[model samples]
Target: MSKAADNIRFVIIMAATLFVMSLGALRLMKLQLVDGSSYLQKSLSSNTAEQVINAPRGEIADSSGEYLVSNKAGFNAVIQKAFFPTDNREINRIILKVANVLEEENVSWEDALPISENAPFEFLPDRESDIARLRKNIGVQVYGTAEECIIAMTGLYETDPQLTDREKRIIAGVRYTMYLRDFSVSNRYTFAEDITMEAVVRLKELTYELDGVDIVQEAVREVKTGDVIPHLIGTVGAISAEEYDQLKGSGYALNDTLGKGGIEKAMESTLRGKKGVRTLEIQGGAVVNDEITEEAVPGNTIKLTVDSDYQRKVQTILENHIYWLNNQTSSKAKGTEANAGALVVLDARSGALLAGATAPTYDLKDYLENYSKVANGENSPLLNRVTSGLYRPGSTFKTVTATAALNEGIISPTDVVNCQKYYTYWEGWSPECTGYHGRLNVVGALRESCNIFFYEVGRVMGIDRITEYASKYGLGEEMGLETGRGVKTGYIASPDTFEARQQVWQAGNVIQAAIGQSDTYVTPLQMADQALMIGNRGVRYQTYMVDSVYTYNMEELVSKTEPTVAAVIEDKTGHTFDKVIEGMEEAAAFKAYTYPTVKEYYTDSYLLTELPKKAAIKTGTPQMTSKSDTGSAFIGFYPADDPDIAFSGFVEKGEYSKLMIRELIEAYYNKDYHIEKLGGRTEEELAAALSDNEDTDSFDEDNEDLED
Candidate 1:
């Protein structure tokens, strides 16, 4: 009976084994016959090679549709992973042939390899880090020699068949560059950018032998404004390795271009478009199918608040004035040279920077070619004096003092103060004025920029009050231009600031501070904002040069940065800015008929009858350090009754006649001398057609410096 039970168990075990084997056979047959096409498709899809498609950078424009900076179609030579040879010796031979073809066609190819191609191989100093990174990638030590490093690279990349000395050198160089560029199987390499058409055609023809070589069409930054607004518009350059490393996660390629300075740098993220990707299914190095996995999003267009025409007019006028100031023999003054100057015009209500110009400037196109010349030249052209250049506000501060004094009840609008030409409130510390006006009210004091009147008022209000008003008007604060060195806020004379800078602020410092002298310094931009604030009756707007941002097609609105209030005067009544503006109106009243509110200002009256708009002005000739040389400053607003435009102009060492604040005002309202207000250009437009191309003949060019 035990033997019979054993036989039955064996039979059952055999039946179970047969059932399991049958199930395995059925599953194998299903995979091979029924689902075969799906598996095949999956297998082919896995062989795809990914490529990056760079998006065109955004075009920059003035508020109008005119473009200041744009992009043009550019040709570049690139390497394709699909066609690239796998053999090390073949790759070296192909790359050398590629280099030879480029050289023959007079086309430049960018090879960032650290080691020299010639014998006695040398490492480039500028590529030290790149070389070290490549070495570490190839298992080389930091102490290894350049040739040893090259030899080490050959073992990994140019292996299998032995490479000749020349072949080894060539392959090693390309390999090192590939490593530095963070090249991968998916990301091919960019050999050259902005190549000529002849080079492109030649490269395409040689693609069979060169293998992987392609001519890709791309966009290159083209400055539409030429040299006009070069400093403000800024420049774009090839991405550094450090930059690439920082942006790699964000899909940035090594050959990408980026803004290096000015507005370009400030608005990079807004201007740079999103990158796209292309995937190709390759079978035995042959691409059988291709697809766009992602679509590139074009960059948003940026519209600047600058009126190209008005800005050019102001720039030309300022330039011509400085040129005259430098050569004027009779008015040959001392102090800081007048080789540099700045002028800014803004919408009083909006704080829109309609125009801002800096002298000793260069065209945007010429920047690359003339970089060394401009950089090494005197009175730096790169320096945006509108915000970065600091100088004493001079007598312009009288308005601030007047505002504070009247607001704090230290002085009444009709109060009288004696300008005995000098004030001696402290013993052995008498501050003298340029003129000896006997007696003057608040209006007369501002009309003449009376130092004594402000000195006495400042004494009553104290330094703290003056500082409070200055801060309220956005003085000694960042202008928020974000245009690199063009937006730095200047220093204000204060006890805290003086202490921080390791200097002393004494009782007499308050007197000089009130007169826009002492340790106080203000930029032309700040002064312009001050003018706008005064014209707007204490409402200081957050000044901006850019107006709006749109898509490339102008069909979609990306962003619109409208004018917003930055600060406002605490005075609820018309006691502060209104009274100070009345004084300003008087200062601009060079003629009796135009603006009869204030007394006659001892300056030229050309703008009174000549321009379309009347102005309220204040003049300053502060001997920055000495009595002989003075910096010319003028703060004014147009149509004194209903202010439209506000202006601030400064010359390092200027005469009163060269201020030309009147001409700038007239140029804005009238189209006759409207140089900077013209529309910008298109992407395809040539540099010769740039706007702001006008003459300086219409305005009165005959004037010498005002006597201090």
Candidate 2:
């Protein structure tokens, strides 16, 4: 009631009003000047959306213009934030519906979340490796268990607090992935890829209930010969976080698919089509303005030198023989069971790979599902033996030693070496020979596979010269398979290699080395190349698989393969190659003549009795541990005078007598059997010698320690 009290209240009210006004003006300044762009973007995002249009990947065809790998139109489920329901409960329900449909169809969907779905949840044991990286990338904090991590993320997704832990975990995982992918109005998240038609139909039928869910038609890789050529063709998979980080500048999205191996990875730039963009104006969960900002460009086509027909037949031959050998009841078939094998056929003149076959094959459809099993299998079906396998040259390497000697003038075709059944050098440590081939020349030495002659000649020529000739023949060199890093170039057996393996090369090493049983190991591809060179009488051509590249319709040629000479075999004794050819001719001819008479005597007999063009072949069986057999190999070319096709084939843990490689050649040529035309019957005599004095150590050339 006093005048002093009224005046004090008035002053307090006026000061308080001024303070509140100052606070409002300061907040307005901060919004307008400091954070204007951030607010503007948020406002724009609510009314805008984008739909990505993926371009079609390239097609791959074989030499005869048949499809090896192509593309088929498929559907992927996606989520668009602009059309998505604002409620977390609605989003969770929609995802569950799609997941249920996919589960019912027995189809796979992308679920990279590390957590297990079971009660008392833990991280997937196999997925543990990816956890540290994923957590770091997504900016998630460390947790003791997967359940703890999920609970932490559930709060981030703002899912219903009353929901069960399982549902919360599922919703949190998908949201976490979307966040990692930077999913927004412009970049939609891929929920599931390569969905089946049944699943797609079910999704579309329930579209009325599924507000934000979308079915996008996508182009997925379609393998034609899925069973025959998985390693050669390879597969495409989602880009990893690391790959995305490295490739983001090159316009790759977080969910982009990339070739993981083989030709696909080799030519990714050519095969990956140009991505297109679609801009849209959305309001109230509806697309208002929509247009394609950039038109998509389909990927270019790749043409290979492979003949799928020949590849298929070759695969069948290997499969059948391996199956038969493994199950054989005959006594002679012992140690002939092939665990793994490789066959490579080359166009001798052009060096184009016609067929490259590796056994213990798998279907491409099962590649992703069975990847772990195949990778961990004892036989290693995933390994491409054409490039990855290394085996001793066995007798197949004799031609190389012969070339080196003749080139260096170390031995003459007529110069005879009296085989005394054993070769003794300085140490009295003699490498025994299977037979005493007396007074044999180079050609006859090759026919009889006389070890003493080669031992003498190779030692006389020295290791350096032999290595030089082998290098010139591309025995230990890359032939360009488009791996970017090239393929495995097998090592030559020598003192230098011996040193690398932490061992000193003694004088005893040379005797076995000379007989193709030494440390010299070669790949099947190299052997095929060597055969091509010898069959062509010393012209080595570069081998390649891809023939050409073109536009999607295969109308415009992008690039083409031109036959290039890799090397030439020059010998000091110019005409000595003819004598060497005579040796191989006699060897094959001898096998042809004695095949029938020795059919019961030996497990494997020459299947090439009649030839469209007479073949010159050299068989090699490498010796390994006393109990375990080494690889069996044969290299040759057809039409002794002029070879068009050069081939090399081998079987791991197999005996040379049972490979039946001759059958493959006969089938390739489609020739009927005729005994009279076979020029030499000497192999029958040799067949008896082979069976009577069977030396496990002499079954093949001795296998030296090889590194690739």
Candidate 3:
């Protein structure tokens, strides 16, 4: 065909093709208009949705209305994974600066970054040609401290598969394929989350000047008063895979905060707040409707039974005494330095625990910042001593023995029992005492702490009779305290003691058992609770720390724990037991249980000075198999005629019973204080008290002497 004719034919063909294409497009549009909703619903179901999780802040408070923790908006600089520095040298420098800044701000960068500057990218596939050039122009001209730079570089290297054996192993696993694919797909991951609030705020306000740094809000624990209540209030941490599986149906997500310690763990059910849900409707790549289906319900506010004033006083006393003892004790065997103990005070009438204190405690603030140090430190300071420490009751168990003696008719209050011999025999078993008392009654036996007297009584009564009596007095049983765990009901040798004697138990063992030794163990709380029962007339009540729990909106969800009576024996069962009580008063008053040669110190001269009122106490030093070990114990009630509160203290392997009791006496009974006088001191007097040059020094020489 000619050129003109061919061009005309081409135009005709193009017109025909255009018309057909238009007709098909119009027909598809018609179909879409008629049935678009069904198709659109089907298409929407396959699309990915962004899950916006609203995390509520955790609440923390002291026993009083003081807030120990509250949320403060924090700024975080999040860098998209796609924008991560590719060059080893450039990444190293960036990390080095970050570390230096963190240290300057008193923040730890170790967990966030652990790679080194000089470390090679061994994990990357071999196509990294631009890294060397990229390292030369990292933009920032400021140089960081060499130490911090090295730390940051090392931190980064250690985290990546290139430098760590473990990471390399993880990279080799097919199970990690999903993680790797997701990481690439999102092109997003966290670089650091612990930037301080101050730094975050500055960054947020000045984002225009900062490149590749975007601020995002992230959740962090608010520790108001530091680590004051770590062992009690507890903490939160990431959920474990096992926990996720167990809580699958309970709506706990993979990264949900889980209670890992203290009351948080104990009352997780009541404390865990509900999480909310959000849904979004997207059309043509634009979100049309965003709906909040549920709102987050924060964890309950727990009100503990602890009286802050008393708790604080006990803590102060303990720390002061421990400090004093540490200073006095010799380096060879410092009793106070190893003074890992607990002090518990409870209402005698009601089982409310007024104070529960433990020594060598970590600051909750330090724990949140340096959790590993608190969790696995050299002192193991995280362990709760009140509910966890169990020791032999020593002579404190005599109260149980005396009750058994009364109930079993082994002895009468008026009937005097001969305790002249150092040894007494019962059922072919004999137990020795510290010394022989010429003549003793049931009252005198307790006054002198006569082991031979109890041995004689036990022989007449037998093992079955001993445990039976002990059970009534609340021994060999859990004290029913709400500590969640570790409050053990110590062993009480059973009727099988005789049978075990045929095999494992011995006559000496029976003798020791009679005097509160052998396999018997009791917690400080149990020991104190039993003493209160005696003072309160046979009423045994359960103990609790939590008073109530409330929601964030101030709605009370649970009431304070009411005192539950665990046991109440007949009052007449041990009514005549007053004779033993009288003897106990003499023992504490005259130090009658001490050696006779120390009479002047044990008489009215010493007794009137320490406890002027009518007070009853018993001190015990149980012999240990290891000659060097001695278990010291003391139980006392002030104004013995009308007791309101009672206390029991035990020191593992204590050197002297007198020293321990002296401190115990001063803790509760010593009423004299110079606080008002000291408070009234003039500035001139305070200044005059300071040394000539000592006041100018910032560092305390005392701190230099502490054990690292």
Best by TM-score: 2
Worst 10 residues of 1 by lDDT: 594-603
Between 1 and 3, whose TM-score is larger? 1
Q: Which ten residues in a row have the lowest lDDT in candidate 2?
A: 699-708
**For residues 199-251, could you state the per-residue lDDT of candidate 3 as single tens digits?**
66655664454333456775555666653545777776655545667976887
Off by over 4 Å in 3: 1-62, 68-194, 198-220, 226-229, 283-290, 322-338, 375-379, 424-431, 495-503, 553-557, 574-577, 592-613, 638-642, 655-708
Tell me how far the alpha carbon of residue 164 in candidate 2 is from the true structure, in angstroms, after superposition: 5.2
**Tens-digit lDDT track of model 2 for 469-534:** 888878888776665332678878889989988888977676677767767777888999999999
**lDDT for 258 (candidate 2):** 87
Q: After the best TM-score superposition of candidate 1, give how far the Cα of residue 560 lies from its true spot, in angstroms.
A: 2.5
Q: Give lDDT per model, in order.
A: 0.74, 0.74, 0.56
Q: Could you tell which candidate, 1 or 3, scores higher by lDDT?
A: 1
TM-score of each: 0.79, 0.83, 0.69
Q: Give the TM-score of candidate 3.
A: 0.69
TM-score of 2: 0.83
Q: Estimate, for each residue in 110-213, the C-alpha lDDT of model 1 and write its tens digit.
A: 56677777778888766778777767777888888888877777777754346566667766666667666656656778877778788778778877788787
The parts of candidate 1 lying over 4 Å away from their true place are 1-46, 86-177, 244-249, 253-255, 329-337, 482-486, 591-609, 623-629, 674-708
Clashes of 2: 1
Per-prediction CA RMSD (Å): 12.6, 9.3, 12.0
